[model samples]
Target chain A: MLGFVSGIDRDLLRQFERVSQQMERMMGLRGANGIRSGGVNAFPAVNLGASPEQVDVYVFVAGMDAEKLDISLQQNLLSISGERKAALPEDAQVYRNERFNGAFRRVVTLPEDIDPDQVNASYRDGVLHITVKRKEEAKPRQIQVN
Target chain B: MSENKHIEAQDQENSAMQARGEPESVMLPPVDIYEDANGFTLLADLPGVTRERLNIQVDGNDLTIEGEAAIDMPENMDALYADVASTRYQRRFTLSSELATDDIRAEMKDGVLTLRMPKRAELQPRKIEVSAG
Candidate 1:
């Protein structure tokens, strides 16, 4: 047998909502086709930091190719450009399409003084990693306090 | 006024139906991309797509997901709000060689499609010890 609760129950409802959303994410991954709307943009999540000597920029760009990517730095802005291509099997019928594929370009700005010439770029798995060494004048320094 | 509005709406709906080809399949849902310490997480919200009809491919730097979203009913069945949409999906990402090609992993749970790409060890930072006098 099951019992019913009154609509006045707030805390219990909140808990139920949280659990339901978590369960939805878990269940969603199993059969997710793609997004619904079209106007959404993909911004690669990044982790960047800088110290006295270097600046690091990391971008999450999976399902992409390194060769197809173009990276450049002008002033404080870093630019990234690439394209996504899709292929279909002969007998397959398309009913729903949610994934984004086509031309993608993203620009990021750096915070510290870096040697653009000394910057290093690499890609592992699907993530793109870039590191730039800061110029001597831009590095933080401490003056002796007497 | 209501009559004119209704007629305009009807004409618009009819044209929409005609353009979309009788709505044989539902449209695909939107997906979100999240990146973290490990790598990238791709989530796709596919509602009625069956595993049998799903097709995933990664060639060179391109990745594509295609499948049909079939709405099958058992005997006497009815449907309501939130219709499912099915269409072909083809996406690609150009990868860099610095990434270890052997470590990409993918999994599907519920109706979400997740693809994980771990960061390579060489790409991660390493500490260097300084010699002291």
Candidate 2:
């Protein structure tokens, strides 16, 4: 009887492991919809806001050179790409490393009403702010009642 | 286990703080620490943080880093979507006695903080010259 109970416990543990593996894969797939291509955690997360005149995008990234950043808009898709170089010397002994260091690209889908030619980007305090003006026809107008 | 030496992260305290019902919960920023023959270097990523908002304090053997990220929202703009929840960042570390706390230098640029903590003169390794008698 004891042997049979132990066998059941082992089976349960294996099933749990399989479920967790599937969950991880699902997370990777979900990332592809918006922020990243195929990764559990997205790099340089962004926030989007819109006003009547324009749309704003804020990207959070630290320790990056402004000249090296690449910001472009093709149709309604905006892509931000750059590389974060390591800070420490090659011979130094690393104790703990939690910061993300490498080349990364994040694509964001903008609204259809935005004018791609009027987009402006600026980097300040390690935050990238992109402002895209709305099309002239897309702007809301206050019509007078007859 | 043997590799875990020098700086010790205060993870238990972080969890405890989260348990309490604080009005503004702090998020720990990711960090990278490395050691050389003379001292240790620490790098922390603090996006959206300005120089005036950053605070660093060292009391006894404890070192703390705290900062507040300012999210700029224009007057006429309304947020359509946001993923970042917290703007406060805090992290603490227990530093070893071998480090020279008084001589520590800090610099912040592009929202990243770099700290250089050198070893005390007496604690650093020294080479002795041998002569024939």
**Winning model by TM-score:** 2
Q: Give candidate 2 regions above 4 Å deviation.
A: A1-40, B1-23, B128-133
Report the number of the highest-lDDT candidate. Answer: 2
Q: Note the B-chain TM-score for every model.
A: 0.55, 0.75
- CA-only RMSD, every prediction: 27.8, 9.8
lDDT agreement with native, every candidate: 0.57, 0.85
- Angstrom error of the Cα, residue B92, model 1: value is 23
True contacts kept of each: 0.05, 0.88
Give me the overall lDDT of model 1: 0.57
Residue A92, candidate 1: Cα error in Å is: 2.2
* lDDT over C-alpha atoms for residue B63 of model 1: 60
Model 2 chain A: worst 10 consecutive residues (lDDT sum): A31-40
Cα deviation of A51, candidate 2, in Å: 1.6
